[model samples]
Target: MVTAKVETAGPLILVVGDVMIDRYIFGDTTRISPEAPVPVVRAGAEEIRAGGAANVAANVAALGVACRLLTICGDDGAAVELNGLMARQGVTLDCVTDKGQRTTEKIRLISGVQQIARIDHDCTVTDAARATLAARFEALLDGVGAVIFSDYAKGVLTALPELLAIAAQRGVATFVDPKPVDPARYRGAFLLKPNMAEFQALFGSCPPDRIVDRARSALDEMGLDHMLITRGAKGILLVSRDGEVVDRPTQALEVFDVTGAGDTIIAALVVGLVQGLSMATAIDQANIAASIAVSRRGTYVVTRGDLDERLYRREHFMTKLVPLAMLCDRIARARETGARVVFTNGCFDVLHAGHVRLLAEAKRQGDILIVGLNSDASVRRLKGAPRPVNALADRAEVISGLAAVDHVVVFEDDTPLALIQALRPDVLVKGGDYTPDSIVGADVVRQSGGRVMTVPLLPGRSTTATLGALGR
Candidate 1:
């Protein structure tokens, strides 16, 4: 996995929209209510933190960046509490308020991990109050690297169009975590991120295969340069204006609570972008951050330390065969850390000393080693009807279990040409008596500035020789 690098000056992110005080009342549910058929929650502990756009800013700060929140609040106790929490998290808040308005607050009563009740106190601001908020937002854009529109459909984001226009005029890159209400309000945004449900609301239903084209259609109508649609456990897709689409799968995670996961995604994405990472790399990092977010309960925030630790752990183990998309993500992350990747392919119908030596030596040539195994059908076509004594799954499992193998991918074709072209590893290794120039994908590796290597075969030890001896 890639190591996340922190810049000394750290990018400054400006978040605009609604801010809220999220109040959690933890209690025990021990008895039924006397007056009604309901479980009684005996209050025990209470805690409050920033929510909505404030949470986005907190996430930005948690990632070791400077964050300023421009929002609307009320001259009330909740607003005061929100401000104090933001201060403690090192997030600057520039809010516009009027005594006549009520600060938005969500009070959730939880009995252990289950929420029993919730109380919402919210209000929208008048046109004059919104104008004041726009002015405050405009004043803070001087040193901002990117602007995030964290719209929660609360009163604070009523003037989204004006704010978007203002950011465009200043040539600032803008990211929006949109509400499902309307698509037109997000016109000219550099990136619009919506979860699957929200995306379905705006663009109707989309087949899994057609998501890219669907996103492109929406981007055209809204004048957005890019759209990132988050698909829960399915990962995210980035569709750009140039008709380029990158689909990144979600990191493997054990989910506990999904609250505030979206906020974490957008925060990491904008920060990575401003740090000069490619959009695909930024989205990969964000997906990793989001995976960490869902593994905990409540509104969890991921820090830079958390990211660094997880990535460091991933570099040390090989668990099982991964999907092609997931393998691509791993390769990209490895590349980010300047690690060389070595790839080899074969139909290992039987394991032998020759295979072992080739894999071990290939691994020695790079930091990562990937083995591409031919599928059952491909093996049948190449090695005849009864060639492969083992199934694809069994062969992949055996290959992945090796200490030298970091990843194993099965290809359906007789040759690994397409897979090699897509992955473009730093070195292509093969175990054979053939010369490097005679290798199947040697030219592909050479054209991409990578080397083609041929490891010497072990004397009298081959899969065919072993199988022939067993036949007797």
Candidate 2:
């Protein structure tokens, strides 16, 4: 599974839903009594944190995503606190209102050691709040990479159909962490994430073995591409056309409160997918996130420091996942000392021994060999109507791992002229009988007082040869 790599989460996320404030009342419990079976408590310090949609945004920001919040709040002190919370977390509040509606607030009463009860207060001005949030949503939809509907069923996500329709029209993926009370509201979302209890509440209880099947059928019936049912103690189940279920027996930890576990899962999943994680990998990260959430005292924000601490403690579990950018730079520097800068541009539609020998010879040239790769679009543009030996990412990854290669950078244009100009290699090498002038970066290298040369072409080793031989 692809673990979190710091720089992988720059994707823009537009979050629209119920934004609320969490007010925690803390006190000491010394004696039980006067009241029937209740302990007499001495009041202590109070605390306030972002809750509901605000909480989700906090989680998103914690993961280093550029998050924008769109929701309604009342012209009250709660709004003041919510605004302050967003600024501190580095999340921008775009769609907001200070109308007659009271901002949604979840007030919790806790004794020194445990939570006793919680109360929720908010504006019921559904019409005004809905209109304000929708206007902001429409305005923010133009450039956002993905949309998240934090449907707490608190009236903010009441207009779920419109939200889904808008995102669909824009070709943007939508993720919804919904309330079980109204499954119909979240239909047609790109993906829906619900905890086990919520899933059972909406789809009815099922034998543990058949739970995934039931969810798949329900997701299809609702027209969703997929569904991720978060099993609190059993782990996470991924349901889709390409289905996968990964189990995580609850991590060994003392459970404090599962207050914002759902919010935590949705936040982590959105960030992972934005950073390009596969469904299964994203689920692992989310499960890790939820594990940390449940271990905390209340609805707490998970920080990078906390994750690093986990990584240090659990060294056997995670390898040193260097960031991709860092890997490229490091390889480039190492090659400068003795490697030859043999570069070849191609769809590399396929990898073969010919390709390997070409790369190896390129490496044998001087100090470092850098390959300028054609992006999927660029490959399709140059290779013909329909051709890319492999997807761009897979191709780059495969090339980067080769022992003879130093770095592989993708360029979407028809040629790697710009990349050549940027890297400015000492020597430019290409395989096959093509002259130096035929190479895209030849001009740049020559202008920079560098040399360009063509390596001997290998016979019967071309991608075309392999494809025709295999009748591909």
Candidate 3:
């Protein structure tokens, strides 16, 4: 449903909550240690990433939205590393440094794909630091379109009620990834995102069928506008104050790790809302983003390009037969992400081994391979009457099913000059018989700084030869 690239010029998103560092020490375990009876890991790599609320902000920025994070941090080395990570992600940091506390950090020892142990250096904010954070929140609320509260119950969100009131007064929408503290503190927020377990912990347990009713009741009781309950493996459920409920199944095919998936959902949801999408549409996009997050290990940031590709695939899932206009739009979006587009046009009246080889080779030349099929009328004009062994629809469908073909567009012209001019693909490909200068539209492609090349045809395979053998 998201047809175009998200406009990044809209509003600023303010993320305020607990921030921490997630450090992973990856190694291979050979045998048990004599002293501790634990596997001795031979260290291979060490990686650090933003965690908690900082992760939420990173995901927001990764979507090309303007974001600023307001959190409390200690004046320690971890704080410095956290700042650097946020800066690299283009997240503006408005952190309150507390000299008396140590910055929170979670160090995980990973053996292969398994986590061996986790060590936590936890820190809580002081009243003085909370006051400072509140002041900073108010100062940054002027241009904020949405506020995200990523609470980890790390003592930073103790003043959530006051912060919610301030954002409410400014008429800015607030979203909360709530901790199981006091539900009343999240009142007046626009939406609250809680996983299945957290939902039961906050509001008393209820059957799956009655979740909507309970969520509606919770929404009314908390003075919230909506609630998103994430059910792992089951899907996401959206309950609004006006008795509208929408449930979307999880999009993940294989979930490698679910770390920071909730953050990805909230971040993408807010971004979608800021882009003027409906609540249901935003939730759908959020579901897609969560699927991408869980496919990777540890915390992951889903970018705009990643979402675009997933949406494109979903749209063309059944078949890659697309109209020229739609294909042009898709090409534009792909080009923005630095993807190379390869194009070749032919009748493809009879699918054969030679055609398959050519398509496969074309895909190897670029990231996306677009096949231009000549319409029946165009084939009649170019190859004479009764030349095509198949209709336009049949040929297009067969070509779209090939693994190397990313998209199939039917062009009416005898030559694909018009499509080539419109699409302006990065690479223009043809069969072996044609030279670079002899290929139709090669000049136009070359004028646009595109490459023109040809692939060698299979010696003994051809549609003409097959038709002759069939005595058609």
Which is the leading candidate under TM-score? Answer: 3
- Off-target runs (Cα >4 Å) in candidate 1 are 1-10, 318-472
Q: What is the lDDT of residue 101 in candidate 2?
A: 69
In candidate 1, residue 366 scores what lDDT? 94
TM-score of each: 0.66, 0.63, 0.74
* Local distance difference test scores for all models: 0.84, 0.75, 0.89
Name model 2 segments beyond 4 Å from true. 1-10, 32-37, 317-472
For residue 255, give model 1's deviation from the true position in Å: 0.9
- Look at candidate 2 and give me any clashing residue pairs: 338-366, 338-367, 339-366, 339-367, 339-368, 340-366, 340-367, 349-389
Cα error, candidate 2, residue 88 (Å): 0.6
Model 2 agreement with the true structure over 221-319: per-residue lDDT tens digits: 888877888877777777874565555565525577787888888888888888878777777777777778888777877654444444433442332
lDDT per residue for candidate 3 within 406-449, as digits (tens), equals 88888887788999999998899999989889999998888999
For model 1, residues 1-472, the per-residue Cα lDDT tens digits are 1122333466688999878888999999999989999999989988887788888899889887888988888888998898899898899888787667888999999999998988999876788888888888888888778899998888778778889899888777889999946888888888999999999898888788888889999888988889999999899989998877889888855788788889999998988887788888888889888988999667777777666555643553424566676678768866875899999999988988889889999999999998999999999999897979998877877887788998888899989998899899889999778799988889999999999989988899987888889989
